[model samples]
Target: MRPRLPSSPPAAGVTRRGLLIGGGAGVGLILAWALWPRHYLPNLTADTGETIFGAWIKIGDDGHVTVAVPQAEHGQGVYTALPQIVADELGADWRTIAVEPAPLNPLYANALGADELFETARDTVAGRWRDAHAVRIGMMVTAGSSSVRTFEDDLRQAGAAARVLLCKVAAARWQVDWQACDTRGGFVFHGKDRLRFADLAAEAVRGSLPDALPMRVNEDDTRLSGQSLPRLDAPAKVDGSANFAGDVRLPDMVFASIRQAPGGSSRLVRVDRAAADRIPGVLQVVTNDRWVAAIGNHWWAANRALDALAPRFETQGAIVTSATIRAALQGALDTPGRRLAAVGDVDATFKDARLITAEYQVGLAAHAAVETMTATARFADGRLELWLPTLAPAMARDAAAAAAGIATDRVVVHPMLVGGAFGANLDHRCAEQAAILAVTLKRPVQLTWSRVEDLLHDRFRPPAMARMAARLGPNGQILGWRARIAAPATGQEVAARLFAQDAGFRTALALTPSGDPYAIAGAVPPYRMPAYAVDHHPADIGVPTGHWRSGAHSYTAFFTECFLDELAHLAGTEPLSYRIGMLGGDARLARCLSTAASLGGWEGGIAGSGQGIACHSFRGSHIAVLVEAHVGEGQAVSVDRIVAAVDCGRQINPDLVRQQIEGGLLFGMAAATGGSTGFTRGLPDARGFGDLGLPRLADTPDITVELISSEADPGGVSELAVPPVAPAIANALQAATGYRLRCLPLVPGTK
Candidate 1:
């Protein structure tokens, strides 16, 4: 929701002001001159004015408040939710609030996200400042559900500073004590004489801005933060006015379609470029070492020409298939791995007690966003400009510059609205391809990947395999627990892809035993045990892998929670009771688990059906899920209802929170039931949606989400509800069919 220019021209003699806020070094401030309304400002300042506050808030002569949101919005309501925090603090009229995406400056970097990146650095002040500086300059990414959690304080402070400035200006203009004046609903009042912010804008600009201000804490104020404000971007999206990357149109723009190699290990052998150029409306054929694309007047023509040319690719080294991948993972599990966590003597406890061991496997999964990967690039005057949907615009800018063989500053990235991004937009291949094609063609080029190409070329969720062993005491109590997981090191892979030349990141990766936090995120069970140990074996399966929705927790939770369910059954106890018994002191997790059970009617088990429950805590939030499912003929499972209880600290917008929980549950259900991508001879087997079995509308179950209200700091809600779904459904399936399904998808005969 970028700010829109006024429809009419400004009145003559009106002064205009462009407020530019500055931060530490390397935090570039985009000039606000271009954002001002042309007709509003009378005596405009030619030189930009500097303020101590961050570059987020801008007040215009017309009393319009514009907020620069650092996070990319992809139907998550960030554009609205963030502004709500600001408007509430400023006591401004919500109708006058407008939101625009912030520039790729370090000033808007996510502080909380930076903390996650440099956890080891937290102990030292210099290290903490270094991490903060990294976040400020181009490391500003919108991932890990950090949009709201990280920026809430900054926005509130910014808004409060503006309010203080306006109130001071109004009090001085009226020759009254500032303490007697109050600001509310975009107006300054002095004992009943009210003045609109618009009338005092000029005087307010001359007032000194506060370096820092205490944010007002009013739990009862429901106008902004706590209320379910309608999403500002929703109207545009529903009315088809929303502009996505695919909707970008430029003068002399040509469409291009690519035919990529199977995986990173594959190479393009040859392509009939001349034949492709001969096709009707085809402009030119562009080829690199690894892939080729056809530029044409239209996307369909380019796509047809690309298909007509039919580039050939060959695998570089060893051919990898599903069977070969599984064997390699199993082999890695058998080898000695780096121990991530250890407590007490697990070996002795296991030797003295009964052992229950099981191995689980999860296949590679696709992002499968509705919008196909797309980017529009224009090269002119020795500079490049790109419009695309990306979660990491700064990273994309760097990658595009490298691909275009130009200086990073010469490239400008304009992030467009994304249709969806379940961590698929983290890679900048689309932007790189578009830039290269634009440079080669010497014109504006729009490149798009067809559904088949997008699915096959995606940086898929890494395939994982886990082996779990639990030692049980004579009284059905858990004595010891051990887990070993083997999967592609996603941290190493992402580091190599995004920061191959970054010495600091490389050193950090080398210093840490586990390559990435995602490698063993949830490998160790949360429940307390006398002796517990977890190990991770990093594997290179010759397939391109990246972060999925929940990252490593996506599969690790499935493995650990399902194994816990197995242990519960072996102990002849209900899943809920078994979990409660183990959760001795964790009141948060216990509350979520019991709340979900109560709402789901755990005690009233339905005849001809069974219910299962699972809980997990990650990303500073706790969640529990209970699923009621029925098994039909031929072992087909249909979920009747799903109940979830979430404790994400304090709530922002209950409606949006519920939406995220429901969406995450459905997404996880798709993965649990029958969503996967297979490989054969180093090539993806599933070409499109027809083969990749995603959940349909009829498959959606009745979902109920209950959120716990607490005064604790807010946590992420986007991916918190997904991790427990697969295990909960699997447990329910076991209850219905008397079969223990360990692997994902729960396909028949895999029990």
Candidate 2:
């Protein structure tokens, strides 16, 4: 039976009836009564003495309140921050709170992110349904730093509803009005009369729920949202009990190692199956069009078998070389491309002014996560089960079922903890391959990509080039700015491949939206420019590119900030004051800049001080970075210190915010100094971490981050710090050496 496509979401908080009217696609919406899923049955399994409360809460006999967190734990502290929300709203003792991975269900889907990724702005019936029921159509991914922002309200409501139910049960037993009873520290209280929630939880689910759930109002003494709770996953990690995807074990599981076409393109031409079979401990060799895998009881044996097989692949066209990529981008920029952002008449503003022009280039950067791709699959009775480190479990299940030749409902995905970041876990090649291996071998299979294979096939951050031309006038007040960037439409491809509801819709999305705003997101400066235009010259690099640490801002920030420094120099003004002056309305961003400068010991980017400053706004978060570095005798850039100020607003865990900022700083530093590679004969020159020039303790600078206080709603912190570091370091180096470097992987001797 063919799988059914998702229909339009319900209207007015009720299920939609009739049909979905998409972009000329006459697809009918399913009847609400048949598949509304408005009321979801609890999917979490309860342990002995534990009572289930809806889909998110479970209360054990000993008073432990466990909250179900749906996002994959990827060192972002979702397990801790999310559970903190539930515990705070439920008025439970922090010590009594625990967390479990939420079961895969529509109730736990990331609908907002899915809708925002690709939903059309056509104002049609499909457009109306975009924000709702997206997970039923697209996927439940955990990227975009949206876990806290998208799910906060839902988690709060779930906790509040549960608390109300528990309070009512307690109030009934105490012979008091339920409205007069309040909960705190895992107990219900009414004028000095109290009872443990554990004692009443068994009967709470049966109580009459109010028409409207009451959300918590956090005041002085009862708020946990701002406190720095100890990370819930820390203890398990230290004790080596955390179950990463690689740690999953099953009865009679076989290990598989695969060899795909190198250089990210090819079809398997031939392989020596007999040689692979002769290898000691080798179970069998499975070959597909795109890759071949060797299965065995041990990974090492399987890897050796793969090596012995010596698979060969054939390429149809000229392999993408660095020269080709450069030529493609240069040609695109030379052409009159689509303009995505315009503040005023840039051509008219620049007509009579002497423009300060510069060109900057950034090379390809890989995700380079320490953990490679790993997934476990077991198939039996036409049903497939997968244990994988993935942000999109629903997407994985749907794709895996297809690969295994089974119905969509016959698949279940048990998401495991991952160290995946920068979109490493978003790919489904491993899951698809594992499912195929399991169905063919008639046994359980666990596949792990070797580091070399991981590097060779990783979806890299697209290489980009920007030509910046700015007109600076008297007093540095009158200015015109134009940035023409050439890069791949990464976000468009992501939307088409991962976010569209069906293949037909995906195809339509990929073809349309020819002008991609996401490709040139940060090209426009935050400063006050009289006239400015940001244009995107979409280049077909003939290589795969996906979301990096900061999306397009990773490169665009470097482009904008570094150019701002050049403009400041041309105008003979202090770089810090010049940027802050342009920040007329963004007080929050200006504060971040000022605070970072103070923290780093502001010295005006002087000749010897080696101080440089950069600030940016991303994902509703504002951040400023300052770097102190020097170009040494051999042109080697040595970083001494890095200081950052962030205003993410309403911290769930201040410690986590600080950690993310710190981590982003280090990741950015690596990218600035060594996180780039060039393609040669369809393969990247950097093959491993050693090749990428990762910073060690000795090479790392002393880093400090300050979290600004704000009562505003929470903003994303994970990728906020990444975009500004490169430009800060580059500007600092220019201040020290009196020379400018316009390319990434800043080699001081280059121009």
Candidate 3:
């Protein structure tokens, strides 16, 4: 449960805090705007001060402790992780700790948000607090695997400073130096004089606060790394006490279900609202720009109403049919686009050595989050209250405020527990829908998307087609390579630029690959091949392609690693040795490859199973993965084992690292062998679970091992493990059989 802030101001601090007196007019404006809403500009700020949950964390006289967390609790385990960070820092009594979510604070923002807001429209921040003291970015949303990374430093520093302050208070009372007082488990001790945290709370607050403090985050100060600490959310999840957004309930809240246009965009010609009105408990039928929603007393009633309310839409015929899109994407591989990268001269190299060209294709995929799209909104008493769990809150706030015709301040967005958000919740559609309906009805409305709708209306992972051509030197070295890809323009252009600045790669040429792991490898690889050129051309398409875990790196890794295996085979050298020779002295890559190979029993192992390796560096972190698979006579491929090694620099939480690896492996397996968002007649054909074959528990590999380097900084572990899995599996298959499969989800006969 979230903690409640005082709606009314406290008598003492009301004047100083700008509470009741100056706030009422603001509140009135907020209310009036909610009634006749307009787009609400959020008051965003970024706080660089020492943040303690003090206003959030209270020490009762009886020694009970409560810490208020500003972030939402979804499956990411913020509830547990946040409290753990606080408790460890404060040396608080863990048994007596109470955790609660804090309402929006305008003092927290992500690195991505910080970079973006500052990168463009510098004037937008005019007159706003930009300094560390007053610039606190809030509305507390978590994404980009940033919760731990962003808050860890500040919280630790605050805790350490607080402890030092409490000891000073005890020392002052004891007439001793601050160093003489020892602190342990929320208590300060001076010789035999013992003072509980609660007893010194008032004095500690009055004492001088430390403005500068360094966190002793070494291994000696923490037992956090390389340990499988139990997940903080497990108990609540097991007890059914966790409150996902779908579990929200409010007074007089009507239910709503919307049927989106079959085609992406179309004109609504007619809607048969009468049939829906006949449903028991049905309230009203509301039509919006792209969706027709049924409002009813209950969810079932709303769904039934939606079922009966038949609407006709004029199609644009612009929807990309799955088969047509796949074919088109493949054809686009030949079409030229903006040059993203280039290295050496691939055209000249192609004419010099034995060449092998292979094209691989992947299909659209959906973000099958456990909790479907849902939000609750209430527009009453000239105010709007919204309960939603969204990845992108700024846009959500604006959309909801605009829909309700209220000023932003009049609308309050309370992000709730998210069941499972795999990037799809970033869209503001649901929030907009709820606000529009609730405002029209002048009542509270709850909207939940059906499974079919969730899948059909999903912004899919864009289908990708890559044309890779490589030249092998006589000694088996890759002399030249060229890769051209066609897919939706994800933010890869930006990432590629960043990668180039850091890696010295040519960003202007489209075919140049980033961080060519095998480029400078020993003996030139494949016995020895020298001088290579590489580049990439990402074609633009209409499909809605965004970040799907590892982004562009996913396909790039596959093309590079699998193509390496093909070259090794052509040169008649063992794939493992060939890779090792190509990736010399890169200790991180070597560790990962060797660990995966050793674990998979690759050296002189059985011929039925083959092992393949791949490695790449992303966002300063490098990882390598190896896969082992068994191929039977009937064309059935069983993934038997996987081994991965990662050098993330330093480990924050080893358990989380392992979890990320497991997630990446699982998701990659699904994408590699089978899962796809199918389409028919320019519309999504795969509507629900049955149509999309996901990786079931039974399909999981029997053996999986994750090896971490002893010394390294903790890089991002969330999405890095995915890119190598597909190529590893594909390469293994190539070694197992006499086929070089270039497409994803290998069909029985294609290889």
Q: Please tell me which predicted candidate would have the highest TM-score against the true structure.
A: 2
Which candidate, 1 or 2, has the higher TM-score?
2
lDDT for each candidate structure: 0.78, 0.83, 0.62
Q: Give me the runs in candidate 1 sitting further than 4 Å from their true place.
A: 1-54, 114-133, 209-212, 221-223, 501-504, 511-515, 604-608
lDDT of 1: 0.78
Q: Model 1, 361: alpha-carbon shift in Å? A: 1.1
User: Each model's TM-score?
Assistant: 0.90, 0.93, 0.81
Candidate 3: tens digits of C-alpha lDDT, residues 300-397: 89988877887877777566676667666766666654444455566776775666887777777677777899999988877778888865454467
The lowest-lDDT stretch of 10 consecutive residues in candidate 3 is 517-526
RMSD values, in order shown: 8.3, 3.3, 9.6
Off by over 4 Å in 3: 1-74, 96-106, 113-141, 180-184, 189-194, 217-227, 344-354, 492-541, 604-607, 631-636
Better of 2 and 3 by TM-score: 2
lDDT for 631 (candidate 2): 82
Model 2 steric clash pairs: 10-16, 19-29, 20-29
| Tens-place lDDT digits, model 2, residues 368-483 | 88789999999988889999998787778777887888877898888898875567777777998999999999899999999888888888888999999988878876478999
Q: Could you tell me how far off, in angstroms, the CA of residue 421 lies in candidate 3 after the best superposition? A: 3.3
